[model samples]
Target: MIFFRSLLVAMLVILSAYTAVVVGNHGMNLLTVFFADMAAIEWPGQFNLDFMFMLALSALWVLWRQGISLSGIGLALCAFFGGALFLSCYLLVLSVQTNGDVRKMLLGRHMPAHS
Candidate 1:
């Protein structure tokens, strides 16, 4: 559990720093570049497409785990746009809340811990 927490913190810090640098250099034109690569039939575009689906899946999981309520919908949006930035922080907080219960962390607070 400690290891997981540490890893999540590290991921959060690294990704946040990297994202800052990227935004600093690129000036927030991610969507244009992201789609342009795909439109041009490039490997980056393929990877972006794959990554986009993965983000969607992450958002879906967040919604499912939250029982699809209004808050769940908001969280799903964050999960979609925020990517690992949202997830690492979410899991980090959940780890503390659940006292290192891996199943609970993945399954949600309302679920039985063991099931």
Candidate 2:
């Protein structure tokens, strides 16, 4: 659990720094460049498409974890667009909420604890 927490924090830090650098250099026109690469039929485009699918999968997982509530749908959207930025933060919060329980973190607290 500690290892997982450390890894999540590290990923969040690294991604945040890298994204800052990228946005600074490229401005906020991510959608245009992302789609343009796909339209050009290049390697970057291929990678982007693969990554997009992964994001979709992440969103689906988040929705399922939340039982597909209205709030879950909102979170799913954030998971899709915010990517790792959203997920890293989300997991960190879940870690705290679940008290480092890996099973609960992954599956959520769907059932009441047996007394």
Candidate 3:
């Protein structure tokens, strides 16, 4: 169960990063786009923030509970992976709303024609 949870977290991070890149390529501010996209779908923006905060807090709590010292690498990974996860989920949701089937099959799938 823990392994699956970790795997899910990793996948979410990758998806979030991909979403951010796609949005950025389309001239959107990653953060604003993420929040707006979530809002449009009736998802609270706080969900993403809260999730990250909880994950970090849980990691810290575990370390403390185990009497383990936190390392810089662990902190870095938490931030990096956590950010990617949040962004990916945000972007994935936004992409679904913005690029429906028609858009995905046509405009989104093709390169823009040069003037």
Task: Say which candidate scores most in TM-score.
Answer: 1
Candidate 1 has what TM-score? 0.93
Residue 72 accuracy (lDDT) in model 1:
96
State the displacement of the C-alpha of residue 18, model 2, in Å, after optimal TM-score superposition: 1.1
CA displacement after TM-score superposition, residue 5 of candidate 1 (Å) = 0.8
State the C-alpha lDDT per candidate: 0.91, 0.92, 0.51
On residues 25-63, what C-alpha lDDT tens digit does candidate 1 reach at each position?
988999999999989888999999999999999999899
TM-score-superior candidate, 1 or 3: 1
Q: Residue-wise lDDT of candidate 2 within 12-44, one digit each (tens)?
A: 999999999999999999999999999999999
- Candidate 2 has an lDDT of 0.92
Model 3: per-residue lDDT, tens digit, 1-115? 3453455567886776787788778765656765675677555666766755766764454333324445533644454455556433433543455453434322332424551
Angstrom error of the Cα, residue 23, model 2: value is 1.3
